[model samples]
Target: MAKNNSRNMSDQSSMNGYIKSICDIMRRDNTKGAMEYIPELTWMMFLRILDEKEEDEHLQSEAVGEIFEPSLKYPYRWRDWGSPEGKKRKELQEGHMDDFLNFVNDDLIPHLKSFEEKTNATKRQKIISQIFRNLTHTRLGSEKNLLDVLDKVDHLTSENIDDTHQFPLSQIYEGLLLKMGEKNNDGGQFFTPREVIRAMIRAVKPDVKHNGEYATFYDPGCGTGGFLAENYTYLTTPEISDLKLNASDYNHLKHDGFWGLDNSFTAFPIALANLVLHGIDQPHIGLKNTLSGRETYMDLFEGAPYKFDYIFTNPPFGGKEGDDSKANFAFKTGNTQILFIQHIIDHLAEDGTCAMVIDEGVLFRTNENAFLQTKRKLLDECNLWCILSLPQNVFVNAGAGVKTNLLFFTKGETTEKVWYYDMSDFKVLKKNPLTINKFDDFLMRLHSDKEEDKISEKSWYVDIDTIKKKDYDIKAVNPNIKEKEIPKPDELIKIIEESQVKINESLQKLKELT
Candidate 1:
């Protein structure tokens, strides 16, 4: 991981250029966009890194007089087939592109995918098998281009990179993940911005090891593992963490601290590879539909606790669930976020805290039974502490234009009052993306104990009594903002008639001139 760390901008630029070059090569053969080439690149990169890591671990075990069993064996590992001078590559021979592609598509992939079928598969073996399960064949249209790709990935080693100023592979993979989310047009389910994720993590920095034991941090709908990844970075970075975490703490945080579930096959493997590159050796992510109770893969999430100590997530907005998903919950609603709210309330520990990105509609629209009951349950069960109304176009870069809000609350207490911060009046543009600096004032007031200090032109608290009086429509309406006066309907119609008469007079004058 240190080999991928960057010391300056030039190193990052070099890696960016390198990755772009690889994409360009893949584009020559297939250009259906990143949906086609990114997955191909992901498996290659994963195997390459995995092989190297196991090699190092093997050496370390040998030094300690321990026998090591590798996750991969001879003629199947990257060095045996992916490299140009590899044994399998030599057997296929140069100029026999058909033979090479056939071996990979027919033999190597199937062998790798078989690891999960074994009754006694090791944890690493299971992870490897799952990562390669989706790779049925090579996406590269040209066998020659495929060889070029393998050679490029083969040369990607720590010694080949400028170690003093190399770009982190984790950050590089993140850039790739952004490409998958950019302008994704499937119902405007935009990926959560990392800046927003970082702010949320800092706002509720849960102890990685809760109650002197391993604490679980979960995301119900983790997209590419952004929230979990940022939380790891926050806890590990020295300047950010006040506690002096030792080696054992770091080990616990890496293996047992971060857990997530994503329903996307496209994103599931990418999330695994991304977390591994970020130094999370054991990412407990499940490839299952969290709401529908359907699973493609949950082998990695075999021992998840019934509840979690902390939950940080952005549930899919503007989506609906079927009866299958709604049936398991206390509140039966098609609203995706609403059902997720119910699920969170059930799964959160008694002392758990959650920071979720939600649709603004949930705060208002007192029109349905499910909506009203869900909000009532949240208020009665949890201390609904704060709601920050985000700007309308905050998701413009990710191709969504809906209004969003951040909800922060803790379980085991009824809400007495709720503090609200209004960032809705500010304009959010693609050129000026929302940054963490925008939350300085919000964070400052959030930490203050005095009620008077939290009141401002853009911040105020609403008592529970007032919230109930309004039927629980807790939308942030700025009191300091003045209402604009409007003319009556008849006056507006008269003004339009006067404008039409002026237009007719102007047209008559033009006719006279002609």
Candidate 2:
């Protein structure tokens, strides 16, 4: 056990060093330029790790070890830089030495000789060689002195590499999120708050036990794959230790059960890489605009017969462009949030449940084409379960406070009473000033299944029909009022005098202007 612990610590240290080296390269170049390079680096590192696993039989016996084996070999895998085949392989390897040294320089020529192919395209081969030369010279080589660094990294458990090692990556992603949030990005609408994601996953509690037996899991507007990753983390955490499944079994359940879609080209790859890092190998994440035309929708549903058991997502908020002719459904309101709500309703299985993070505007606004009707449809057609009111500053970093709520509901039978948890004070502080971690408390209460109707300071339940009559508005409004009399006239006069002098000066300025 001591040896194992020491080994694990060493692995963590080496992994940390690799991450730092990559970040240094990005910073030295340019942050924006680094984004392009980082993804390529991630891909190469992934491939190298995969190749390393294939070489080590003991590691291959582990649960996650089986999934990292690379099967896809484009033509570039065969070419040599000095020769035609070497050049092709080098082009695809980017600048990562692991591929150039292991595959192209040493392996490809001998392997491809059986095919009786000669090296082709000398000019293209030279360009590929130069690129590989630059890549081989990077800090990656300095960090990995003799496969010891790679061996050390292989020892890192998923738990050790959580959000910490991924922080720099996350910072880079946050920049992408910010760019998405900016005007003209058109992709910003799908960026959901991480807190909102945690809250939704907490409410549903998707676990490994519920895997094969339960229905599917999905996210329509899966942005950077936060919803999917959170769900995957929720199931695999030590909290679910009692599930007693091996790592391989868990990986299979996750890869097979989780599915996601996003239209953004950049977001698609990021989401796919995020899942791979989180242990869901070969994730069913695809690039498809969920709101595309009916034909496109039909194409998406072509061969899949399974319905989702649970759906958790924060679809792009606000309305989409009205001029786009390829929209899936004709929504009366131009609001895209309503469209996502309808899409959730359409795709949700009869036995499935959904926890969607929607803008507060969808709760109370009562225009003909507004989300009010969609809220009514949920209550009238499905089982409206709960609405969680999240606090402000939850999404402050993203720059939009459109107060959001978690609309939890299930398909099929409608429940007469819906639960409303007023968590307005469940504030997530920027600096955690009060040293309060509200989510810990919130999860405790939720998992306990305490009676929410009985009044509590921060949380309570309300009747579904009552909320319906109020147009399904879920905001917690306290009716208690306190009245106080004004101070003495002399004090009031003194306060008025202070304001009067400033008013007189403003009036004189206006008179002079006239």
Candidate 3:
């Protein structure tokens, strides 16, 4: 029967079931009713999964064998199950799973009448009992059934679980992404283009060899954890064509490497859910403003003396005007992008590499807004490795066609020449509707690690001294020029001849009518 049901039900149906189960809880609670508010749902689902896992014979047996038994007496079991005061107590203790379960199941459910007179909402009390009863009816199947589902979930063999679960989670995240995009929060800053993200990740290429013995990864502006998740995906090899499962080392890395920080109360939970859903066990996520100069926020880097081996991000840009008063201490300038760049540079390990997407204004602006100084500092202090000029219409869906560039750099070495790849003419990425087209060739070129072929039309290297002389203006050094030009008289005569032919035709038509 289970096999038949599993076979008949589509993946969409199963996803809907999960979503409906969540919605039912939300409707009852009257909390923010969107799934994108993932923190609330994440906490609930974590408890639900724990309860389900506890009830499983296989997991329970394993739990007994493991160092610690599942905390059965605390969080998993519902409290006040059969009590008259159940409803009143349930609301007060909704999120406090451990204490509520212990008190209600062990004490109140057994001695319900004693508490009934003290509780408010007698009808709600009755409803609460019924809800608990209903909850018990919802079964996640036996141990064997769960194991089968887990097997499918664990089918990814890539080092990054993000790619493995990207399909399933993308369906979940798209709804949230669209909602966040619509809100226009932080100047529509929450949304980061995936192709651009992929490009950054591809450029950095964080791997075991590059990261050292125990490399740490972090993203201070970890929106929905897209940067972290993409980094995770790139590190892992995709499932082989003939292989049954996608291959990955994400779990191993997460246990040792991954960490993130975000300030958005809304985005924090989504980021956590993203990491967990991607199979990172106990993701080390924290909530703090990356732009905060406070010692408490900066203390996150205390233990990790060295900077990250590789960092990739698309920090919020052009939202600096509203809250410039309390910007980071490291940021002497008013520009938010420059501040973030400074922060990234400060946190970087001496040997670390980084790639960041920034507004085009950061490149060419010669004003005294500290923009030129910041540019000078970047060139002088770090190895300004490469800059890829991304195409316009890349972020059209977000209602911005402003040109952007991918700035790649490293901490220790001073760069002599900066590689410049003009992807301005590159086609847009299809899945990313915001962008015109993805520059797969650019990524391929980076991956190949080859030097410039002077003959190649789209790419070349520029001297740092020349860029510095130009005040770091890295626009199109070479533009496509037409081989020939039409003379003015000839062009005018051609236009006149076309107009005369049209007039002649009109006259002949008039004659016919007469």
Q: Best candidate, lDDT-wise?
A: 1
> What is the lDDT for 399 in model 1?
37
List model 2 lDDT by residue over 280-398, tens digit each: 55556555777654231122223443467778888665545363522555455567777777778888887678988877777777655456777677777788777777775455433
Q: Specify the poorest-scoring 10-residue window by lDDT in model 1.
A: 1-10
Clashing pairs in 1: 4-167, 4-168
Write the residue-wise lDDT of candidate 3 on 1-514 in tens digits.
0012122223544545545544444444443435323443443333333333344644657767854343333322322121113344445345554543454335533432222243443422322221122122112223223223322322211221223244344444444444444433442466676767876776676664453455667776787777876666556534411112222344456554667766665565566556555445445555566775323222222344346777777777675623542354433666778777777887888778888887887787876546776777777778987788877756643455578888999888777888778867655545635332355666667656455543256667788888878877765444443345666998889999999999999999999999
How high is the lDDT of residue 375 in model 1? 94
- lDDT of every model, 2 decimals: 0.82, 0.55, 0.55
CA shift of 55, model 2, Å: 3.9
Predicted candidate 1 versus true structure: per-residue lDDT over 25-128, tens digit per residue: 99998655777777788889888888888889999999999999998898888888888778878888664648888888889899988988998888788877
Better candidate by lDDT, 1 or 3: 1
In terms of TM-score, how similar is model 1 to the real structure? 0.90
- For candidate 3, report its TM-score: 0.66
